[model samples]
Target: MTAGLRALRRRILTPALSSTSLEVRGFRKKNPTAQELLETVGRSFLEGYGRIVEAPDSQAAEPRLEAIPREFRGFAYEGAAMACSIMDALPGSGGRRLSGLLAGRGGAHTYMAYVGIGWAMARLPRMLHPDTEDTDPLLRWLILDGYGFHQAYFHTDRYVRGQHRERKLPWPEDQASYAHRAVDQGIGRALWFVGGTDVDAVLALVDAFPPARRGDLFSGVGLAATYAGGAGADELLRLREGVGAYRPQLLQGSAFAAEAREHAGLTVPHTHLATEVLCGMKPHEAAGVCREQRPGASDRVDMPAYETWRQGIAGALVSEGRS
Candidate 1:
C-alpha cells in the first residue's frame, strides 16, 4: 500500500465524498488462496477499510477446508465467508479456475471486497448505536429501516452501484456541499460501521455476479427501501409496498430474462438476494442464480439502472410532499 492510497482513502472519508468514493481492493486473481487474500483483506481493515472475513466453509466439495493454511484463521469470519463465496462461484464447472471468469471480468473479489466494505459501513451504526435515535436520514431509511428491509439488508447494491458526482441536498442547507463528500468518504465508514461479518455475508452472497450484471440486475429492480416520516413518507411507502409483493423465483439466466419481459410493467429487475439474507440460504445461491439466468456470466453485478431509478423516485417522493 502506498502513502498516497492511504491519504486518498482518508480524504475520501469526509462526509461530502463518502457515498461516491468506492474503495475497490483485493483479488489479484481468480482464487488467490485464502491465506494470501486474507492478508490484503486484513490490511484493508487496518487501513480503515472494514473488518470482514469469511466464515469457515462447510459445503466445499474440493480443495477441502483443511487445505486452507492455518495462519489465515486470524482473519475475521466475515472475510473468510466472502472469500469462500467468491471462490465457490468461479467458472471451473466443478471448481476449475475457468481462466477468464476471475480475471477477465474485473475480478470477483474486487467487486465483493468493495461491496463487503460498503455493506459493513452501511450497517455499522446498528452495531454501535443500537438504541440511539438516528439523526442521519440516509442511515435510517436505507440502511436500518425494516419494511422493505428485505431488499436493503442484502444484495440491493448488487444492483445499486454508488455513482460519484457533485450534488446538493434539501436538508442541512448550511452543509449543502456535503453530499458528494459524504458519498465518497462517509459511505465507506457507514458501511464499515455496520460491523464485519454481517456486511461480509451480504457481499459474499452478491459477489458471485460480474460487475455489469450486478448493475443491470439492480437497475431493473429499481428502488427498494427509502426514507420515511420526513418528506416523501407516504408516496415512498406506497412505492415500497407496491414493490414489496414481488418476489424473485430464485432461478437463473433465462428465467430472469423471462421475468423481466413478463413483469416489465409492474416489477423491477433486481439481483436482490432475498433468499440468502432472509432465509439464510447458502452462499452458493448467488452463483446458482447467476448461472441459471446469465449465460457466459462474468463476475460483475450491475447497479447503474437501479441507482438512476432510486434518485428519480427519491426526488419524486420528496417533491410530492410524501417523504
Candidate 2:
C-alpha cells in the first residue's frame, strides 16, 4: 500500500481517542484513578492499532509497539494483533499479516494476540472471518473471549446491561455451542471495566446472569482484575470473597492472567497482588499451575482441550485448598 493509502486506512480504521473515555462509554467512574487507568489502556490499544495500520507489515510495527510502557505494552501488542488480523481478512490481502506477527515478538503476547483476533472477528463480515483451524486448539477460544469483550465494551446495553447472549456462534465448526461459554468469559472480563473495578457492582452484574454462566463470567473477572490492576488489595479481597462457589473459576482466570503476563514479561505489581489474594499464591506460582495443567495431545471428543485446560487449573486450585 502507498503511504497516502496507509494514512487513509489508518484514519478510517482507528477509533477516536474519546471512545475510551468513561463518559463516552457510560461506564461507571468509581474513581479518577480507575477511570484514568482504564482509559489509558484504551489509548494504548489504539496506538498499537494505528502503528500497525501505518506500517508496511506486522514486523515493521514492532518498535512502536515496544515503545509502549511496560504496564500497557501488552495491550498495544493486542491492538497490533487485531489490526494485523483485520488486514489479513481483507480481500486479496494474502492473509499473512497475523501469522507474521505471531512469529515475532508478538509470540510472547500470544494470549492477548488471540484475543485481538476476536476483536477482528467482531468487525469483519462472517465471510471474511479468519480461519482459526490452525490456531492453537486450546487458546483459540480466547478469540471468542475477545469477541465477547468487544461486544460488551462497545454495545454495553445489549451485552452487559441487557444480559444478552449469542444463540449459536458460526465459527469453530462442531463446537459452536461452546463458543457462548468462551464469550461469557470475555463478558466477565469486560464487567471489570464496565463496573470500574467496583467489586460490588461487578458482583451484582454477574449475579444477574444465569447460574451456569456465572463460572465463566467470574473467570473473566479474575483475569481482568489480575491483568488490569485497577482494584487494590481491599477490592481484590472483596472480589475474592464475593465470587463464592465460583472461586475456583476465579482462581483459574487469575492464573491465566498471570501466565499471560509472565509469558509476555509484563508481570506488574498488581499482577502479583491479585494472584496472591485470589489464587493464594504469587503470580509465578499461579502461572506455574497453569503450565503444569496444560493438556498434552488429546483426542477427548467430549470437551475441547482449552476447556479441559481451564478445568484442570480450577481443579488444581480446589485440590490445593487455595482460597
Candidate 3:
C-alpha cells in the first residue's frame, strides 16, 4: 500500500480519542490522576494502533512504537498487535501478519499481543476472527480474556451492569464450554477501569455478580490492579481484604500480571507495590511463582492446561500461606 493509502487506512480504522474519555465512556472519575492515567492508556493504545496500520509491516512500525515512554510501551505493542491481527483477518490481505510480529520483537510482549488479538476479535465478525486452533492451548485463553475486557470496557451496560455472561463461545471448538469463565476474567479486569479504581465501588460491582463467578472476576481485578497500577497501597490492602476466600485467586491474577511485566522487562514501581500487597511477595517473586507452577504439556484432557496453570499458581499461593 502507498503511504497515503496506509494513512487513510489508519484514520478509518482507529477509534476517536474522545471515545476513551471517562465522561464519554460513562466511567467514573474517582480522581484526576486516575482519570488522566487511564485516558493516557487509551491514547497510547490508539497511537500504537495507528502506527502499525500506517506502516508497511510490524517491523516497520517498531521504531515508532519503541519511542513510546516505558510506562505505556506495552499498551502500544498491544495496540499494534490488535491492528496486525485485524489486518490478517481482513479479506484479501495476506494473513500471518500477527504470527510474523509474534515471531519477531513482539515475542517479548506475547501476553499483551494475545490480548490484542482478542481486541481484534471484538471488532471483526465471527467468521473473520483470527485462527487460534493451532495457538498454544495454554495461552490462547488470554484471547478470550482480551475479548472479555473489550466487551466489558465498551459494552458495560450488557456485560457489567446487566451482569450478562457469555455462554459456549463458538471458537476453540473442543473447549468452547470454558470460554465464559475466561471472558469473565476479562470483565473483572475491565471493572477496575469502569469503577475508576475505586476499591469499594469495584468490590460492590463484583459482589453483585453471582457468587460462583466472583473468583474469576477477582482474579481479573488483581491482574488489572497489579499491571495497570491505578490503586494505591491502602486500596490494594482493602481489595485483598475484600476478596476474603478468593485471595488465592486474586494472588494468581497478580502473579500473572507480574510474569507478563517481568518477562517484558516492564516492571514499574506500582507493580512491585501491588505484588507486595496482594501476593505477599515482590514482583519478581510473584512472577517466579507463575513460572515455577506453569504446567508442562500433558495428555490429560479433563481441563485445559491454561486452567491447570492458573490452579497451580493459586494453589502454590495457598500452600505457601501467602494468600
Candidate 4:
C-alpha cells in the first residue's frame, strides 16, 4: 500500500507541482519547499479521488437536477473534492488562489479534460489486463460510463473488420484523428475550468493527437462538451453535431462487437445527463432532463462512473499541490 501510494504520488502528483515558485531567490516562500509541495499535492490528489459523495438527504437538493443513483449525482461536489485535492497537493505559490479558481467553472473544465486523457490512455490496458484491478475507480467509471465495455473491439473486431485490420485496433490511426481532437478540447475545458482563459496548450495538444485535422478538431470540442455535459444551449448544439458525426462512422462495428452492444447503449443517456449539467442545470435537474428525454433510462446510470471520480481526484491533487 505504501509503495502504491508513493508511485501515485510521484507519477500523478509531480506534474502539478509549482516549478515557477521554486526558482525564487532568498528567504523562500511559505511551505514552498519540494517536500512540502510533494506532500500537499499527494494528500490533495488522494483525498479528491478518494471522496465519494453520498446521496443528499431530502430538502437539501439542488434545483435543476432530478433524482439519480448515488453515483450519478453530485458531480459538482465531486468536482469540488477533486479541485480541493489538487490545490492541497500543489506548491503554495498560487495554491490558495489556484484552489479557489478551481471551484469556478474553469475547474469543471479541467476536471473533464483530464478525465478524457486518462480514459484514452487506460482503455486498452483494461482489456489487456482484465485481471489487474485499476487504481483509479473514477477513471474506470468514466471510461466505461462514456465508452462502454467494447473489449471485443480490442480483442477481435478491429483485427477482423476495422479499416486498419492489418495492425492493432484503437491504434493512433484508428481513433486518434477523432480522439486526439477531443483530447485537445478536453484540455481547453480544463483551462476554462481553472479560469486561466488561455487555450493555446489545449489546442496544441489537440493538434498533436496523431491524425490531426481541422474538422476533427472542431468535432472533438463538441464531443468533449458532450462528455462534460454541454453547459449551455450553444454547447449542446455543438455536441449534437459532434455526436451525430462521430456516431456511425467513428464507432460502428469496429468498437462494438456482438457482446459489446449493452456497453454501447450507455453513451446516449449519459450524454443527456452531461448535457443537462453543461446547460446549467443542477445535478438532479439535469437528471430530470435526462429522464424526460428517455424514460426508463435508469439502467444506464452506473455504466462507468469512476472516470469522473478519477478526474475529480486528479484535479484535487493539482489544487492541493500534491500532484
**Candidate 2 lDDT, 1-323, residue by residue in tens:** 89899888999988889998989999999999999999999999999999998888989889989989999999999898899989888778888989999999999999999999999999888998878888887788899999999999999999998999877674755787688889999999999999998899999999999999999999999999999989988999999988899999999999999999998999999998999988889888999999999997553446878899999999997799866
lDDT, candidate 1, 136-202, per-residue tens = 2322222211112212323335312332222432124443343222232222222221112122322
Instruction: Tell me the TM-score of each prediction against the true structure.
Output: 0.23, 0.97, 0.97, 0.27
lDDT of each: 0.26, 0.91, 0.89, 0.29
Superior by lDDT: candidate 1 or candidate 4: 4
Write one digit per residue (lDDT tens) for candidate 4, span 1-323: 35456445445533232321223211122233332432332333323333211112111222211222222323333333333334333444232322342344324333332332243333334333221132233222222212211121122223112212122323234333233333333333322222111123223333333343323333333333343231345434433344333322111111111111112122344354433332333233333322232222121233323222222322332233211
Q: Number of backbone collisions per candidate, in order? A: 80, 0, 0, 61
In model 2, the clashing pairs are none
Model 3 agreement with the true structure over 246-312: per-residue lDDT tens digits: 8988999999999999999999999999999988899999999999988876523458788889999
Candidate No. with top lDDT: 2
Distance from true location, Cα of 109 in model 4, Å: 16
Angstrom error of the Cα, residue 252, model 1: value is 11
User: Where does model 3 exceed 4 Å of error?
Assistant: 298-301
Better of 3 and 4 by lDDT: 3
Q: Distance from true position, residue 314, model 2, in Å?
A: 1.0
C-alpha RMSD in Å of predicted model 3 compared with the true structure? 1.3
Off by over 4 Å in 4: 1-16, 19-43, 46-181, 193-283, 291-323
Q: What TM-score would you give candidate 4 relative to the actual structure?
A: 0.27
